[model samples]
Target: MSERVLIAGCGDLGQRVAQLLLARGDEVYALRRHPPALNNSSIHWLCADVARAETLSNLPAGITQLIYLPTPGGREEEAYRSVFVDGLQHMLAALTESPLRRVLFVSSSAVYGEHGDEWVDERTPPAPLGFNGKVLLEAEQWLSTQPVRSVVLRLAGLYGPGRMQLIERLRAGLVHAPRGHWANRIHVDDAASAIAHLVELREPQALYLGVDDTPLPLNELYGSLAALIGAPAVPEGPAPAGLGSKRLSNARLHASGFRVRWPDARAGYAKLLDTQ
Candidate 1:
């Protein structure tokens, strides 16, 4: 049976997921405040504010699967809570009577805090440092007690075409990476494809670390990227004492037989460079 997939907070990542579903002939409903003009007119776009429960009635019926990837309205706690927590709560309540089967929450590795050189997997207990992480943790915990199954993917630095702040920074010159801190990443396409793969799985796992095979040193990553884009090498700043220097493990992601086209920064960023 084809799914009625509803994408809440459907932004760039959500739109990518929608494309994958559309290719499989699944119905797509995108809920965004102002959904951009889509190339695929087949996708049904609904405009509503997720934080407000009263606006949720605009949501479609019989949503079998949902992808919650809300963008934070701001960096403050109130902003984070409004979208990640309260918004999520409103969404869940609205779907109470629907046939929603499972939800794939696009969470962040920030929830794990700073593990320094330690390797973090799904087994690592979340100890968030900031309110943004706190909000995500609260939502993840709340989702666990819900009727529907939840698959939480703690993605690392998400990068791809158009999302090129790092590349642009390198071009601007004088960019610096923390001397020894580790940097983790996932290509935008891979992130979207992973969600599609999990959706197709007969039994998807509860938690998966959404990262690639390589967790390169920050300076090394920037250096390679700078070289690829023909930008000047960035200076390296001192690695801070016990900061965000953690490495994420994608062992579980690999165990599930999911393969990313660009498994490392070099392969992923090279494509962008070649296209430019």
Candidate 2:
């Protein structure tokens, strides 16, 4: 069943999500701060900032689903509150007024706080310690109270193309790993695909942990990437005291019939390095 989809914040992740929906023959209405640089007839680009209620009010009616990908300007507490909390309120307000049935909010796994080496699943309580995590938690809580059918995807560190933070550090010869500390990651394409899957299924008020299958020491992952790029591996240090180490379980999503194309960091890193 094809349905009209409206995407708020059609930036990197949002644009990729739009592309996926377009390829599937769905009507895609993407809201961005500016017009897209590329010419794509399948996407209807609307210029509007999601932070403003008035801007959201202008959204076309009869939208079947909505995807919120609002950007947190920085790690500052104020920034997170303004964007994730306030912006979400505005987006939800408009969504409530529309005939939208399903919603998918792309949240972050940071809501887990620092859990050392312990696997976190959808049932784990959110213990957001930092500003970013707190803001996302608040937004998720706000969404949970709404009547609309919604799902919150707590995505791990997203990597691909221009968004590979760790890979960029490795490429720039700035790779430094804390000993015994591991990191979770997922490909941007996979993230977008997960969002699309959730939208299509219209999962109600559910929470999903989006991450790759492999969780390796931060140092080992960097070494692998460095070797792939024919660069020397950077030195490693002791894991930070407060940082936690744990793998994220993807069983829930997999059981839901959504499989990650890049199930591990090695496979994802290979593709990213191959492109370079």
Candidate 3:
């Protein structure tokens, strides 16, 4: 059955999710503090700051699903709390007054902290070490108490147009990596598609770790990306102090019957270069 979906924080990822839902024949209402650069005529765009409940109070009725992609500002813990934690509280309060059924919260895999080359799955207990990770964990806890059924997707490093960290480093000829350090990532499209898939299937109260199937050493991934972009590969330097390496297992998401469009960094990089 087609349903009305509300997408908060309609940035790159949120906008892509809105596009996918609209293409699937679902009614999508995108809420953003500012207008996004989207060209879709079918989407209903609303200007509202989710940081305040008053802005979200008058949402159109019958929203079956709500996607929250909060934007954290400032570096301090207090700032993160105000935007992520406080804003979520306001959103939850507003949703409680509505008939929203499902919610998808986009979180970061940094919630796992530095795992020292260890593999983490959905079953792993959250051990967030950094401020960002801790803030997200706090937001996740706050969302858990809300009445709506929710899915928290702890996404790995995000990469796509205008957001590829590796490409940015490579273009600057400043790829730096300590020996033996590795990390995982998922393209933005795949992340958005996964959310669309879950919403379409009505999966609730589940946590999914969204990551690329392949984990690459920092040096190799940077080198490959530079090669693809026709840029000179930068020499590797000593690994950064305290950098931990870890691989993420996406078997659960795959088993859920959603295949990642870019299963590995290599494939994603190839497409990125092709489109560039």
Give the Cα lDDT of each candidate.
0.86, 0.81, 0.80
Best by the lDDT measure:
1
What lDDT tens digits, residue by residue, belong to model 2 across residues 104-173? Answer: 8889877876666777889888887666777889998998898887789999888888976666677788
Q: Give per-candidate clash totals.
A: 0, 5, 2
Return the lDDT, model 2, position 164. 67
Ranking the candidates on TM-score from highest down gives 1, 2, 3
Best by TM-score: 1
Q: After superposing candidate 3, which stretches have Cα over 4 Å from the reference? A: 36-39, 238-243
Stretches of model 1 off by over 4 angstroms after superposition = 37-39, 238-243
lDDT of 3: 0.80
Worst 10 residues of 1 by lDDT: 236-245
Task: Give the per-residue lDDT digits (tens) of candidate 1, residues 149-222.
Answer: 99998888899978889888899895888765888999999999988888777788998988989998888898
lDDT for model 1 comes to 0.86
Query: What RMSD does model 2 have?
Result: 2.0
